[model samples]
Target: MVTVKMLKPYYVKTEEKYIRIILAYQYFSIIMNKKVYQFIPVKSTEVRINRKTKKIENIDDVFAFQKGKEVLTISMSQLVSIPGFLEMLHRIAESYYLPEDTEAVSDQQRALDQLISELEYENVRRLIDKAIDNGDKEAFLELTNTLNDK
Candidate 1:
């Protein structure tokens, strides 16, 4: 069974009003070699208060049930081709992506250090073999001394 999860849409603020970009799993589909995305416009709700009753009576989802429809469908290629889309995507990624944990980062650094040490050891072993093959006594002694110091 597939569970459908609703993702919080990205809100882009403009000079006039804020626009909600409602993106759902159902809005995207892969057709042949192209990926398609459907965009729906959403508006903020306005609540009205009844002065006589001293209570809030009604609220409306902005642009939910308006007279006209403002739906946009764009393909992956088209979306990328649009100016400022890539910049918007970069901004979104920067805002949404979480930073790496300090502990996890330190662990990765330690692993990298270990791998580098192993590679250095392997390279030294190869150099030692080459020195022995060439009958270079000075190089062999220097290499052995370096290994002993380590």
Candidate 2:
């Protein structure tokens, strides 16, 4: 079994196209034969997170978590498979989407409005994905229309 041992982001880099999140230390570990092993990187690692989907856009970036010793390089698929990996990335990614650096109350309200809209959009989209996964065609069509109206 594989689980995230550590998921604290050391830094988050945001760009117009994508968001890059850097997490270090014992980010993930696996249990084999009743023995636990931590993710150890041989080199620096990075992943590009999609803003809308809140998922890893590609696995081309090198990544293996490191702590002290126990350096074991893992595959991109392995990293992606961790249960909370995407959710963790999404939590960090949302901050970038929300407006920042606002000074006035009116501006703040506008930012909050934008944040609410974005959150609603994301929630609808996520539901749509779940519906597709569950093969609920009715829900899919309704969600598509809702998104279209938005």
Which candidate tops TM-score?
2
Give the alpha carbon lDDT tens digit for every residue of 10-114 in model 1.
442222122223343333222222323233434332222332232223322322212225333333344444455445444433433333566889999999999
Cα lDDT tens digits, model 2, 1-150, are 666555666678988767877655565455544556655445645567765556677675555543356445666666677787667667767887635434677888999999999999999999999999999999999999999999
Model 2 pairs whose backbones collide = none
Q: How many clashes show up per model?
A: 0, 0
Error of 2 at 2 (Å): 0.9
Candidate 2: regions farther than 4 A off? 26-41, 65-69, 98-150
Query: What TM-score does each of the candidates earn?
Result: 0.37, 0.50
How far off is model 1, as Cα RMSD?
15.0
At residue 149, candidate 2 shows an lDDT of: 100
- Model 2, C-alpha of 56: deviation from truth (Å): 1.2
Q: Give the C-alpha lDDT of model 1.
A: 0.44
